[model samples]
Target: MMASARFLIPLGIFIAVAAFLFKGLSLDPKEVPSPLIGKAAPEFSLPLLNDFEAPFANGDMTGEVWLLNVFASWCGPCLDEHPIIVNFARSTAVPVVGFNYKDRPRAAKQWLNRHGDPYTQVVVDLNGRIGLDYGVYGVPETFLIDQQGIIRYKKIGPLTQMDVSQDIIPLIEELSQ
Candidate 1:
């Protein structure tokens, strides 16, 4: 009985330690809500992906309910979410702006070209500086902005078709008014 108790005590301690480490290290998805929500988006003047002359800033986002989709070729989930974005673009009148996160320009362009781009404008965040300012923790993040250029909602993972139909579309409609 003493031998069994000795083994069990060590095993229990190991389990508790592992559980504490995991709980402390793991990321909580919902805890990181969009900081830009209810606030004006940070101003940036990023040069358009193939055009040095045509630059875009937060000023360009005026008067429309737009989507800022953060993605990268290195992220598998971003690839998974690409098709949903393409389909949503076709289905809605709202514009989506692409922030290609921390990826090579050639790869970013190729991925979009192969998968089909839904963005009206694509900006390259080569160092993820813009994403940092936006409080992004991962790729495939999406932000919904209102007509006055305030971020209204943020979706963390690959947005599903149901999410588009239910959560997103309704918010867009409401904000557009």
Candidate 2:
């Protein structure tokens, strides 16, 4: 009985610590309404992917309501959602910026070439440092930044047509004014 009690005590402590760590660590995907809403978007400066040229920074996106899309060449859903992004760019005044998370330069270039780049600017976050700053837990997440550089909305998964029509389009419309 004493041995069992001793084991139980340690096990209980371990479980408590594990729970605390998980809770304190970061966001869980099931939690929908992100806290970034109506807050200034996180600032980051990352190297541009095209031609390995000038840096694209958060400062560059200020004064505009923009979409920041986190994608990876290796992520399948990103490829699936690429065309929708293109259509959005073609039809709307809202600009899209791409965060190429954790992809090789060659793959990033090829992905853009084959799928068509819809972003006004593309930044390659090779080590995911920028993504970490942006509170990204996964690829294919998108944040809507308002004209004053505040993050107004966050979409956690692959953006669907309904998401575009119901959430994104409405947010863009509201911000455009």
Which candidate comes out best when scored by lDDT?
Answer: 2
lDDT by residue (59-149, candidate 2, tens digit) is: 8877888999999899998987888888888899888999899999899889899989899988899999878878887678988888788
Cα displacement (Å) at residue 122, model 2 = 0.4
* Per-residue lDDT of candidate 1, residues 42-150 (tens digit): 8788877777578788678899899999998889999888889999899888889998888888888888889898999988777888888888886889989888888
User: Which residue pairs in model 1 clash with each other?
Assistant: none
lDDT for 90 (candidate 1): 91
* Model 1 lDDT at residue 48: 74
Off by over 4 Å in 2: 1-32
